[model samples]
Target chain A: AQSVSQHNHHVILSEAASLELGCNYSYGGTVNLFWYVQYPGQHLQLLLKYFSGDPLVKGIKGFEAEFIKSKFSFNLRKPSVQWSDTAEYFCAVRSFMNRDDKIIFGKGTRLHILP
Target chain B: GAGVSQSPSNKVTEKGKDVELRCDPISGHTALYWYRQSLGQGLEFLIYFQGNSAPDKSGLPSDRFSAERTGGSVSTLTIQRTQQEDSAVYLCASSTRLGGLFFGEGSRLTVL
Candidate 1:
């Protein structure tokens, strides 16, 4: 079993501001990490994911995340955020035990981007 | 030209009633998942189906909740004797190999 923890419940940022959301997981074995975004009135969409390669991964809309294995963290970051970035972000983890392991999701961070 | 699709975008049922939500996964996805999203809450895993077998039902909150996938494509989530607490957005997602999920618009269930 795996679990994910998001440090921030809500975040507010002005336009063009740099944003970073903290995410941590509690899995000792190999795992797959993902960040999903759900915009207002929209379904959950995958932003990015890390399976077994580089720690740094880039996603749609200029978003990125760094997988720090030592810290058990995979934090989402963006150099500059726009008003359209307002959405709820979730961090998820899937252990490598079974090919179809269940993904554990965090409580999600509601991001409000003000112009 | 296809993605996951769920039926009855909104479902309203009385307490203690039975409700069934449907999901049509992507054409070739081998994995399907069901999740519940409460107002201002995170997505809670309900059940998972890989192909035709479900290895984990631990995410189901109670025995009243059950789900099944047939032909490894379409899925149905049935909640028996539903409660008011079940009022939330029931989401369905499908993945080609459990890496990235393509989600449906979701079926919003309101237990009144």
Candidate 2:
């Protein structure tokens, strides 16, 4: 039952508001974490990823995610939001066991930034 | 092509009917993947291919769902005896260097 979980289905915030999206995974070994975004009428694009090294990884468009191994969480955060940031965000996981290389994705979170 | 290309941006078929969706991954990309996206379920991994060979097919929902890749370029996902629950946007992606993926617009299937 190893899977990714996104805490929010929908979120609304005004421009310049701080944003935080929760993502957690249940897995037993070393894993890779990622965040992807799909803009309206656009294909899904990689926002950022965490493989190793520093737990905090920065990505495009002023987005960053902190991987907390103890908590099994990789939460996405942004200091300020923009109207253009309105889109669907997905959390994904990839385990490195080498037997199964499936990359599982969470349900996703829809963010609406009001101007 | 510049990115992954999926045919039939939208498809509507009757229940129990079989449908085929095609994906042309970026040239030289050895890794290709298929995923199902729906309202409730965000992204359901269906299959993965590496150089015309499938290493993982565990994510396929049932025996009715099958996929194949040819020449390490084009892939086809076949759904046999489709059900209403099969209505979803099917996404295809090709992995670039360093594990970054390039996605297609998706083929949206609507089973009536």
Q: What is the C-alpha lDDT profile of model 2 across B20-59, one tens digit per residue?
A: 9999999888888999999868999989886644458888
Candidate 2: regions farther than 4 A off: B96-98
Interface RMSD of each: 1.0, 1.1
lDDT of each: 0.91, 0.91
Docking class of 2: medium
What TM-score does chain B alone reach in each candidate, compared with the true chain B? Answer: 0.95, 0.95
> For model 2, what is the error of residue B3's alpha carbon versus the real structure, in angstroms, after optimal superposition?
0.5
DockQ of each: 0.86, 0.78
Clashing pairs in 2: none
Question: TM-score of predicted model 1?
Answer: 0.96
Model 1 reproduced share of reference interface contacts = 0.91
> A41-106 in candidate 2: lDDT tens per residue?
999999999989999999999999999999999999999999999999999988766555557899
What is the Cα-based lDDT of residue B108 in candidate 2? Answer: 99
